[model samples]
Target: MLPSGTFVLGGAASGKSAWAESFCESSDLTLNYLATGQARDAEMDQRIKIHKDRRNDRWQTIEAPFDLAPALAALDGDSIVLIDCATMWLSNHMLAETDLAAAQDDLLLALQSCAAKWVMVSNEVGHGVVPDNALARQFRDAQGRLNIALAAHADLAVLVTAGLPLTLKGTLP
Candidate 1:
């Protein structure tokens, strides 16, 4: 069977995206990198460049910072989609004051309708000190909820720590 949906969760700089990329490379399908990050600052721009440089030219990159669900829905079934990641996409919606519940529902619906194999990367944000500010706490909660939901929906789920993969749900394909 084609890799249906795989979720990769990890803390910051935990190499989850790199793992997901390599996982996609295991398949022979057309590779599609759906980037949800925006170059909002110099540091982020440099980080994005590093990520871009890591991928081979065979990956067709799609910038979907604000339109992840729609972009995902538009992909062909024969493609292997790597959404690296969902955290930034969530942040974008939160910053825009969008209805996150509704947005998440839409994203899940889009995923249900999608035919391509999916590898989704997201930050595991709940394993740290509590934020002092209300906005930060809210973001943390939302991210946690989103992560749980995605994990439940995924055919396979893996947690990355210290650059090691630990399968949480189904076996790695």
Candidate 2:
């Protein structure tokens, strides 16, 4: 059987996405990269391009910047789905001032019922010093809470640093 799900967290530049990509690509199954990044600037565009170059055409990329739950619903049962980076997705929703609570609720429901191997990537924003701006602080806390909730439901939780992955909870199968 599939090893349930994994919620992976790390800081910026951490190997979290790379590790998740590796996990998905190593498998012989059809791969799905659920990209959450939206090219808001040139830097971001370059980052997205770098990620794209790292993968071969064998992997299918789905650009779901928001309403990620619906994207999950549309996926067939046979793919290895890796949602690369949740922070960007959260930021995207926040930019639209979307209902965070409702989105998370729908996401949890989708995750629980999804009959596929899912790896969610998020930035662990709570580990560092608090941000100076109130909005930044709120974003940090909200992202942290989101990660915590996902980790609780995930069969595996991983913390990545220095290109290495440390299993925080559960086993890899």
Candidate 3:
């Protein structure tokens, strides 16, 4: 059985992904990488390639940028899921002009029903300045709200800063 669920949050390039990976590697359960990022630009494509290269062949990589609920539902209980970053997922949804409320509902519902060990990644966006556009503002607000909700439900909520993981909600065993 899965030990528990966690949310690994951080700013850009804060080593959240690496730390979360280490946490998962330390476990004996089967690993599944649920990638939330998409190759939209040359830079993102390179980044995605780098991440893919870093992961071992033992892990099954699933690219689900928007509707992760379905992916989570399809997962077996014995596997561990690592959602690279919620920032990208939210960006994908916002770029598609998706229904934020319904999307969030689906996302949370997926998490609730997931049986495997899940380590979700999210960016800490509220510490930044206000956006100039309405859509940007809406995205920032939604990200903050979504992070808060996810953190509250997570068994372990950690903030990664300067490559350091700080426990904010739960203890690391």
Candidate 4:
């Protein structure tokens, strides 16, 4: 059986979201997708469309670009949520100039108290070269911290590289 929470970590185009989606689909519970990405430009719009095309009628998508706690709280034990992912969620918060610590705290609390099983997808940003700008550096630092926290809180943590999953914390179901 899948655990209460799973943290899926990977680099860009590492197939983490696809793996997570498959994981959730294997579960008998109702599937809920908590999308955190926003299409602010043409490239992003195309990306969103591609993701949307991959999911069928079985997945009920909730768009929470900035705030996710409320949508996460609304799920019940019969549901399995795939938050794809934390990287975009953090970016949204950072761009909005929100308090990162408080926002992260709220997210963690909500995930902890939520009744439904959940899988969170996050990018492994620290593997890349150090960014040159202040804002980029800040985002990298924040993403690293968030990933650490999520991994600590999750019952199962998996790292996806080149579409392969390596268990980091718990046994894969």
* lDDT accuracy of residue 107 in candidate 1: 84
CA shift of 38, model 1, Å:
0.8
Candidate 1 lDDT over residue span 31-127, tens digit each: 9999999889999999999999999988999998876777777888888899988999999999899999999998888777788888889999887
Give per-residue CA lDDT, model 3, range 88-143, as digits (tens).
Answer: 99899889989988988788778888988789999987777777888888888999
Q: Which runs in model 2 stand beyond 4 Å of their true positions?
A: none
Output the worst ten-in-a-row residue range by lDDT, candidate 3: 1-10
Top candidate when judged by lDDT against the true structure: 4
Clashing pairs in 1: none
C-alpha local distance difference test of each model: 0.89, 0.85, 0.86, 0.94
Higher TM-score: candidate 3 or 4?
A: 4
Clashing residue pairs in candidate 3, if any? none
Model 2: ten consecutive residues of lowest lDDT: 1-10
Model 2, span 1-173: residue lDDT tens: 44668898888898788888887777777788899999989999999999899988888898988877777877777877898878998899888899999988888888888767788999988877778899899898889889989999898998999889898998765
Backbone clashes in model 4, listed as residue pairs: none
Model 4 regions more than 4 Å off: none
* Candidate 3 TM-score to native: 0.94
lDDT tens digits by residue: candidate 4, 53-140: 9997999999999878899899999999999989999999999999999999999999999999999999998876888898999999
Using lDDT, rank the candidates from best to worst: 4, 1, 3, 2
Q: Give model 3 RMSD, 1 decimal.
A: 1.5
TM-score of 1: 0.97
